[model samples]
Target: MKYEGKIVLVTGARRGVGRLLAEHFLNQGAQVIGFSRHEDDEAQLPGYTPLAVDVGDPESVARGFEQVRKQFGRVDIVINNAAVLTSQYAMIMPAGAAKGMLDANILGTFLVSREAAKLMRKSKWGRIINIGSMAASLEPMGDSIYAATKAAIATLANVMAKEFAALNITCNTLGITAIETDMLGQLPKDKIDAVIAGLPLPRYATAEDIFNVVDFFASERSGYVTAQTVFLGGVN
Candidate 1:
């Protein structure tokens, strides 16, 4: 659909791919509401509103949506992108490390998607695009917690798609490979290279690469596609 008048909300929009998604919507003339844990950046783009919010907190997610409703009146599309990759090794994982991963990746998604659906239900039309990871499917060496959370998200999307289809709403997940984002900064160079070598494609995913799929989901043409996890690694 035309984004000219559509209201889009993107989580984790302070930087990385989430920021790019927000930017794409704004460029298309949509009113964008961006939720970030960080303070609003100085280099603000037009047609976008940045709100500091931690999606894992139900109160914060609710407050963020309240502001979006007040500012844009309603939301048509929601991109759940805020996630954590702090757990490097399952054996060394701290007391609450796994719980922390679930809080941000699973519970956070549940909270935000639930709120966004409320607004979309009003219009009887909505799109929910989850930002997932290939690690969820591949289960790489040290990503047990992260993988589990994303796996849960994928299932969540599947169920939401079934329930929301009657209301003309769509829910889906995009399981992406390694992208050169802040999330990747946590790993060492050799580890990163090992990851890059695993992908069928030579290059890592760019923010633009992920945004393309998100853009497709935001379109009227994608109304019939839901509950599917589109993996965007190079021909694997």
Candidate 2:
């Protein structure tokens, strides 16, 4: 229970990788607050508090953190896992689709990280883990906008690492590729197969794979490891 007594906030906790991460933290004895646009009543997990908020909206993010402060006294860790991906070639990608990607994948990560840092500074120690994508470096087809957003997240995390260093807050990005989740289910079969074949591991990543890296970042032992993007799935 490395995170025992810590207060953790995870965005997009309703399902997929976010949900798995939240559960992992709770299992480690951390008080986990899940932020998503809607509540996951089906989860019904003990020790997990679900908060409804659109991370893309500044007002919504502010209110959500206010509630966290009021209820938890402080936030010790923040996992910016909320993001959206739409597969479309840049030439014909809809404007609204692009905007949605920007709003959730870009704006949402920024807003949540900004607010979480405020609460974390109170204790002079915290962990900020931003979920990133290999698409940023790989530049895979049908992922231009999504990759751009992930690139922004890595940049933001790097700056936050430097800015928050004095406060003992470490910021890092975990760029994952070909994760087996509902999000991946949206891609065409051929595309998914091709990605898997190219990966050195030659297999899709599981939620457990992501949890391993996140667990490291959330540990007190990882204080010196910041401003780095740790890519997974043997992509590089």
Best-fitting candidate, measured by lDDT? 2
Question: TM-score for every candidate vs. truth?
Answer: 0.94, 0.97
Error of 2 at 7 (Å): 0.7
Query: Which lDDT value does model 2 have at 59?
Result: 93
lDDT of 1 at 161: 93
The RMSD (Cα, Å) of candidate 2 is 1.0
Query: Mind giving the per-residue lDDT tens digits that candidate 1 earns over 121-227?
Result: 88999999999988887787888989899889989999999988988899999988877778888878687688778777757887778878887887889999999
Please identify model 1 stretches exceeding 4 Å from their true place: none
lDDT of 2 by residue, 1-236 (tens): 87888899999999888988999999988889999998678767878899999998899999998999899888999999999999999999999999999999989998898888888898999999999987888888989999999999999999989999999999999998787677878999788788778877787778788988998888889999999999887765
Angstrom error of the Cα, residue 142, model 2: value is 0.9
lDDT of 2 at 79: 96
Highest TM-score against the true fold, candidate? 2
Compared to the true structure, candidate 2 yields what TM-score? 0.97
